[model samples]
Target: MKTIALLVVLTVVAADIEFYKTANDNYDIKALIANATELQAFLDCFQDRAPCSELTASYKKNIPEAVVQACKKCNPSQKHMFRQFLEGVKKVVPKEYNEFRQKFDPENKYFDALEKELSKF
Candidate 1:
């Protein structure tokens, strides 16, 4: 009976686990950042100034939850990649970075907390 109860608890715990999609994890963020056109596409997509590809759309859809939750669902690699991406964007394209902040964090409620969380990884 104890063994059965343990199995049930383990199953429940496993079922509760959640994570963000990893399909785009392997994309070369550094290359994307270095390319002006590709970077602008991402910016336009996020800002709704242009249509988004399926991949970018997925990210755009999740940005709010990811920010508010401090990327709790993100895996370690994602955390590192995101940190790099954010830093790169801030440094390489300050104007677009601000636009992204305005779009995603309009009231300025979450960027600082998000930055704090990202810095952890």
Candidate 2:
């Protein structure tokens, strides 16, 4: 029974990793949002802050530690997708992006940081 349980756990973990990889490869918006939300949650993981759950997906219960690493591996494609997504968001709902930008990073520091990282690709 222990061996069976271990196998089941391992399978679930493997499937999760595989799903992240596939999502990274495809630049799926849901996956991107999940990662972004997780990252934001981590950033605001402080004493007086509430979690920014609005940006997160319901199905993603926890943050994947390797999301950024996976993103880096597919930087070229992911960067393009990210830029396109941002542009689309601005076009479709200008106010929403502005509000999100202010809420997540008021000074635009995160955007600058991302720009630096994505430039390396």
Most TM-score-accurate candidate: 1
Question: What is the C-alpha lDDT profile of model 1 across 8-63, one tens digit per residue?
Answer: 99999867868788558767888989998998898899889999998888677878
The global Cα lDDT (0 to 1) of model 2 is 0.46
With candidate 1 superimposed using the best TM-score fit, by how many Å does residue 85's alpha carbon deviate from the native?
1.6
Provide the TM-score for each candidate, comma-separated. 0.81, 0.38
Worst lDDT 10-window in candidate 1:
14-23
Clashing pairs in 2: none
Query: What's the true lDDT of residue 81 in model 2?
Result: 56
lDDT of each residue in 7-31, candidate 2, tens digit only: 9999987666432233333446544
